[model samples]
Target: MQALLHKIIEQPELHAYWLNTLSMMENVGAKKIKKCEHPIFVNEVILKHASEEARHAFYLKKQIQKIRKDACPTYEWQYLLAPKSSYAYLNQLDIDVCRYLKSKHELKHERLKYAAYLLVTYAIEVRADELYPIYQDVLRAYKSPVSVRNIIAEEQNHLEEMEKQLKAFSSEWEEMCRVVREIESKLHSVWIENLHQELGLS
Candidate 1:
C-alpha cells in the first residue's frame, strides 16, 4: 500500500481517481448503514456514523480538485481504479461476517444484522485507521497538497466506538473480530493486488 501510494501520488489523474474511488467506497459504507437502519429504533451513534462517513466521502471527492479539476467526473466504474475488487472488498466481507455470525450465534433478523454491522464496521474502521495514516505519510513525504488527516481522526474515533460497542454486544467479541479480520485480510489483499496490477506494479 505504501509503495502504491508513492507511485499513485506522482500522477495527478490517477491520484484524483484514487481519491474518488475512496469517496465511492465511503459512500457505499454510509449507504449500508442506512439500509440496515431499524424502522423504529434508529440510534444516535448510527446516525452520527452514517453522517461522518458521508462527509468523508464528500471530503475525499472534494480533494480531487486539488489534484486536477474534473479528473474523475463521476463515481462510475470506468472512472475508478480496480473497480471490481474495490467494490467487492466490503461486500464480500459483509457476506462472510454475516454468515459467520448466523452460524456461530444463531442470530436472526435484527440481532444478526446488528452483530454483522458491528463486526464489519470494526474491521473496516481498523483498516481505515491504518490506511489513512500511511496514505497521509505518503502525501507528506511527496509534499502533496492532499491530506486525509481529518478522515484519520474520525476513523480513530470510529474504531474506539466500535470497540466499545462490540464489547457491550458480546462476551465473545474478540473471537468474532478475529474471524472477521481473517475474511477482511483476504479481501484486502485481492483489492491491493488489483490496484497493483492496474498500476502495472504487480
Candidate 2:
C-alpha cells in the first residue's frame, strides 16, 4: 500500500490531482474555521492555521500548474479519464461529516463543536505529517519542487498546534482523540480503496 501510494505521488499527473484536491480541502477547512465560534485565543490559533492552509493550497496549485505545463497532453488526458482522485473522495467525506454533525445540532454547542473540530483537525494534521515525508522524499528523488519541503514544515507546525489545542481540552482529550482516530481510520481505508480503484490497482 505504501509502495502504491508512493508510486501515485511520484507520477506528475496524479500528483497534480492530489495537490489540487488538497487545495480544495484546505479551502473547506478555512471556511469551516471561519464559521466556528470559539474563545479569542482558540479562534486566533485556528485562524492562523486556516491562513497557513490557504497558503499551502496556493503553493500546491502553483506546483500543479507547473506540472501540467511540463506534462505531455496524453499523460494529462489519462488523468482526466481516471476516476475521482482520493483527495476528492476524502474532501467529500469531510463535508458529509460536517453536515451530519450540523444536522444533529452538535455544532450548536460552541464548546462541543470546538472540541469536535479540534479532534478532526488533529487527525488530519497527524495524517499529513505521516504522508508529507513520503511525498517530500519522492519529490526530492525526482527533483520536482522545493515548495513541498516548506509545506511539510508548515504541516509539522500545524500538527504541533493541534496537539497543543488537544492538550488544552484536558478532560475530554483522550475520548475525543479516540473517536477521531476511529473516524480517521475508516476514512483512511476509503481513501486507499479510492486510490486503488482510481489507479486500476484493485
Candidate 3:
C-alpha cells in the first residue's frame, strides 16, 4: 500500500486520475446528503458539510489544471482510476448501513435515511482522515503542485463533528462505528487492490 501511494503521487497520469477519483467520491457524498435533506428544513451543519464536500469535488477537479488542463474533463470511467471499486465503495456502504439500521433498529422512512447518512458519512470521513494526510505527505515529499493540506484540516474537523452527532443519535454509536468500519474496510481494500491492478503495481 505504501509503495502504491509513493508511486501514485509521483506520476502525473496516476495523480490526475486519483484526484478525479477523490473528486467523484466527494461529489457522491454531497449528492447523498442532499437527497436526504428534510422537505421543510435541513440542519445547518448538514448543509455545511454537504457544501464542503461539493467544494472538495470542485477543488480536486481544479487542481488537475496544475498537472495539465482538462486532464480529466469529466468523471467518465475512461478518466478515472478503478471507477468500479471507487463508485462501489460509497454505494455499498450506504446500502449495507441502511440495511443494518432497518434490521436492527426498525428505523424507517426519514429516520433510516438520516441514520444511514450519519454512519455512512462518518465512515467516509474516517477514510478521508487517513487518506488525505498520506497523500499530502507524499505531495510534500515529491514537491508536487497538488496539495490537500486544506482538505486535511477540514476532514479532521468533520471527523470530530461526526463523532458528536453519532453519539447523540445512538447510545450504541460505537457499535455502529464498528459495523460501518467493517463494511467500509472491505470496500476500501477492494478499491485499493483495484487501483493497484489499474496502475500495474499488483
Candidate 4:
C-alpha cells in the first residue's frame, strides 16, 4: 500500500484524480445539505455531517495544493456525475433511497427519512473506516503527510453517530436497512474497483 501510494503521488494525473474525487464528495454533501429538511434535531445532525464533509474537502484541496503549488485541482461536474463514477454511485444512492421512501408514502414520516439517511451514512462511514486505515498505514510507512488523520477521526465520529441514530428505527426499518446495505455493498465494490483502475492498480 505504501508503494502504491508513492507511485500514485508521483503521478500528477493520479494524484489529481484522487483530489478531484474528494472534491466531488464534498459537493455531494453540499447538495445533501440543501435537500435536508427533516425536523430540527435530525436536520442539525445532517447539517453537521455536511459541514464536516465540506471541511474534509478543503483539507484535501490543501493537500493537493501541496503537490501542485501553483494551482489547486478541481473536479468537473460532468465527470463526477458520470454514470459509472463512484461519486455518482454514492450520490445517486441517496437520491434513490429518498425516492423509495416517497414511493412507500413514508417520506413525510417523522423518522423514515432520518432512518434512511442514517443507513446510507452508515454505509459510507463504514467504507471510510476501511479505507482510511489503509491510507494512514501507507502514510506512516512512507513518512508522507498525515493530514488524513483528522478526516479519519471525524469519519469514526460520523459512524458512531449514525449507529446511535440507527438504533432508534432499526426494528421498524430492518428490511429497508438490509436492502440498502446490500445495495451499498455492491456499489462500494464497484467504487473501489474504479479507484483501483484510476490509480492504475488494476
The candidate that achieves the highest lDDT relative to the unseen native structure? 1
The C-alpha lDDT values of all candidates are 0.91, 0.67, 0.90, 0.67
Cα error, residue 159 of model 3, in Å, equals: 1.0
Query: What is the Cα-based TM-score of model 4?
Result: 0.79
Error of 2 at 161 (Å): 1.5
What is the per-residue lDDT of model 2 for residues 150-183, given as tens digits with 9 covering 90 to 100? 8788889888888888888766566657666777
TM-score against truth, every candidate: 0.98, 0.77, 0.97, 0.79
Model 1 residue 185 lDDT score: 89
Identify the superior model by lDDT, candidate 2 or candidate 4: 4
Instruction: Quote the lDDT for 182 in model 1.
Output: 91
> How many collisions per candidate?
0, 0, 0, 0
Q: Compared with the true structure, what per-residue lDDT tens digits does model 1 show for residues 4-83? A: 98889999988988999999999999988887788899889889999999999999999999989877888889889999
Q: Write the per-residue lDDT of candidate 3 for residues 40-145, one digit (tens) a residue.
A: 7688889999999999999999999999777999999988899998888888889998998899889999888888999999999999999888888788888999
Q: List the residue pairs that clash in candidate 4.
A: none
Once all C-alphas are superposed, what RMSD does model 1 give against the true structure? 0.8
RMSD of each: 0.8, 4.4, 1.0, 3.4
RMSD of 2: 4.4
Quote the lDDT for 63 in model 4. Answer: 77
Instruction: Order candidates by lDDT, high to low.
Output: 1, 3, 4, 2
